[model samples]
Target: MNVGQPKHLSRFPAKTDLTHQEFWRGLPTLQAEAVLLGPGRLEYKMLQVTGRDLLIFRSKVAPKMASTIVPHPDWVVLMVPVDWHGDYVFNGQVARPFDVFVSGGPDGYSTTGEKRHNLALGVRKSSLKEACANLSGRYIEDVALDDQQIALGAAVGTRFHRRILETIAASLEKSLGSGKFALDAVVENDLFSEIANLIMAETIEQNSVSSINLDPVRVVRRAEELFEDRTTNPPSIADLCKAANVGTTKLHLCFNEVYGVSPIAYLQAKRITQARCTYLSAEKVPPSVKDAALSFGFTHSGRFAKRYRYFFGEYPSETLNKR
Candidate 1:
């Protein structure tokens, strides 16, 4: 478990800023929300990262009313509990406060509690993998060893690991300040180095573990190609699984392990990218955002709007009007 002074990220009131929904529709970014519940409901604080990989938010919650927050389809989250007790589920894994857990999805992780103190960080998948790749050789059949066991030591090795986690956490806090633009790259590098080092060292020590044997690399490559193809309908997950000749669970893990996001998230990201470009190109048409979302396969406009707000900040109308 990692611990430090809690830091508050800058919050943009999502409910008040209607145009913020449009901003998310136009970019690839990491976004986060910190909610402090009151009487019935109060405005949640939103932080949208335009050109960054890491985000951190600390919230003060009440002890009786639970909060359910859903993130966008482009984030993999890490939650550290500073206070309270609750069930934290990511994908299918359930975790307590002291245990560290990782999961990939476009939709992000979820937590419910009346009152809790927590630190939430969301990093982009591509950035995450690139960061992890810095420790290329230590990977056992492409699966990094860091995710295999809980790292808790007090030696030179443990101290070093602690330092790395601290650096990453500190860099995240820096993102909430004026030097954010510059600190983005720094944080990514530090995070990657730390993860790679830990994984590589553990891999060397744990040589007894079996190696991974799968075709996720191929599956991911084909999936990316399908995502890029806009002419006809691309292959579904099953089709791609067949095309790659891998099991569904293996394929899911591979894509997530390599890309830091699941297959579905990758597809949705592609659709959103296309929709943004289309929306930006047709300022003269004045089409509804719903129509624009539909053009790219986002059938649930309200959900799309919420995701848009998370990724960008303004609603689609604001994006159109700004053009």
Candidate 2:
């Protein structure tokens, strides 16, 4: 695959004569309701790749301004503030600069003191799940950050993190400008995978501080046992919580602390691993990807293929073909 310019791009130039409605319309992934507490201006831009969406925006609003964001179901939002001060309140927590917010849930609200500039990435859920699988051997659908925010602090300043961010920024800039390139599909997949992995890894590593006290060792072992026993049909989060004799919040914290992924994500990885093993072992006459997926409780072959590619960095067909 060759790397080339993206086939589609959208830009919304900065304008001082912008209404709240206009600013809301310019947002890429979410339908937001913005209330301007005082005078200010908003500028927005967006770039779309095959499977990912990038957004850059700057909002100058009053200290009391707030916005409610509702994200698309199939996408997860990653907010990285570029230049700004003040905090965003979401999920009953405050998010500040250098903190990345990853959410794919109910309506979220954010408020800033004054001016705010940030880059938000809208990634498909499958892509993020695959990234989590690659990084932690788990298929995490969503990561709940500490107080709904992952504080980068000195972590973002590190050479490694800076390099990854720079690379992503450069790619976006190139795609936004000349818009000419020959990027292979597989190569593009790998590039996005790497970017997601780097960002998630850094976020997980830096946000390791958990205020909740729980026996991570015990919780992990019990959860592992439950997943092992019910490999064919995994238990739900509620079931896991009930079996573990813990609430949902504690379960999440415990799993995150021990495995760097949620319980459900770990279960997903286990099932995918099982499916892969079955497919690989069917040597003489392999079952089709669809067959494997169905045998493992996946009804949608298209989504299965995407998740499989994200998790293993190759298509299910490719995996079977290797044999």
Q: Could you say which candidate leads in lDDT?
A: 2
Candidate 1 structure, TM-score to reference: 0.38
C-alpha lDDT score of every prediction, in listed order? 0.46, 0.52
Candidate 2, residues 120-161, lDDT tens digits: the string is 555565555544434443325444322246676644424323
Model 1, residue 3: what's the lDDT? 32
Model 1 spans > 4 angstroms off: 1-51, 63-74, 85-94, 138-184, 195-323
Candidate 1 on 213-271: residue-level lDDT in tens? 65567767865665555323433443444444443455567789888988667656666
